[model samples]
Target: MNDVSMPYETHGRTGQKSRTRTALVTAAREMVANGQTPTVDRAASAASVSRATAYRYFPNHASLLAAAHPETGTQSLLGDDPPDDPAARLDIVIRAFTTLIVETETQQRTMLRLSLEAQDAAPDHAPLPLRQGRAIGWITEALEPLRGQLTDEGLHRLVLAIRSATGIEALVWLTDMAGLSRDEAVDLMRGSARALLASALPV
Candidate 1:
């Protein structure tokens, strides 16, 4: 019995559909990595899939771009054996997060451009996945040890500050504007995360 409510990929010929979806997403990511914002049709062409099939997976440009975003579905930045100390945990998470940002800078930049364009096109448009604050969840999880010591608001503020210092936006300014090397930018971001956490701790 086919469940009509299921997603297209899960409905029929699941293996082949899943492969088609992965190919589309892979093509889109490759395009994004090369500094191109890809449409579903373009991604389909790149992936050697038909336009009709691509549209079945991604209904629009926004949906395709969102699916291509490097950080779209990430749920956590910490490792399986993350330390209990909030500072150590934060350091681990921030380092991993910044590394991902640097390695995927091209994709990040494309998404950032799209996000800005979307904002300019519609003042009230919902933010793209790039600006949707997934890092906040990761940072908050890394700093969860401080939840008891600090109020929820305080912890949230700390998370926001760290996120502000350690993401792609900060990376772009540090590298392009401040003329820092990628390594320097990452180090500074990690230091800023630690400093923010230290400030929130008792002296």
Candidate 2:
């Protein structure tokens, strides 16, 4: 299972090869943080490694970019033993989601740029990694306890509202435009999530 988590090319000589793979991934992440959509060749150059070695780890642009996205591995925000109360579940998920965005803001920003660029090039296509609506799934799961309380459409709308407020787009506005610190931005997002959830519940 651990080997499945490792890059396939590093399986034989794990030590040195793993370090090299890490270097390439770290270099790719650094480029992404700096607002560059890096290629395998570019990452190799940045890492001071040979292009051939980098290609072994990431064969194509999409694979390299995917590796650079920090949230690619996260399928859920709800921890084990999640509460049944919708509000509590939402609060827990929102905190975790907001922390992830704030910590990986740079990588998030890079993917946002790429997603927008892809949109411009091809409208109506499924969005790139950052815009793939993974947060929607997480939010929906958090609000699952509300299913009997609200209509399907109402619950979906509430989930969308919470997701809109808590995602990277809102974070960019809160921190970059509104000049709030990251922690302040995260707090506002959490408040927004709670407010949206409350507004959808019984009066």
Top candidate on TM-score is 1
Clashes of 1: 0
Tens-place lDDT per residue, model 1, 1-203, is: 11121277767698888778778888999998998878888999999999988888887887777777888767788878889999988988898899999888888998889888887888886766446677898999998988789999999989998888988899999999999999999999999999999998865
lDDT of 1 at 33: 90
Q: Which residue pairs collide, candidate 1? A: none
lDDT of each: 0.84, 0.82
Among the numbered candidates, top lDDT falls to 1
Q: Worst 10-residue stretch by lDDT in candidate 1?
A: 1-10
* Backbone collisions counted per model: 0, 0
* TM-score of each candidate structure, all chains considered together: 0.92, 0.78
Give one digit per residue, the lDDT tens place, for model 2 in 1-203. Answer: 11123356646887778778778778888898888888889899989999877877777666677667777668878988998999999999999999888888888888888878767887886555445577889999999988888999999999888888988899999988999998898889999989888888998
lDDT, candidate 1, residue 195? Answer: 91
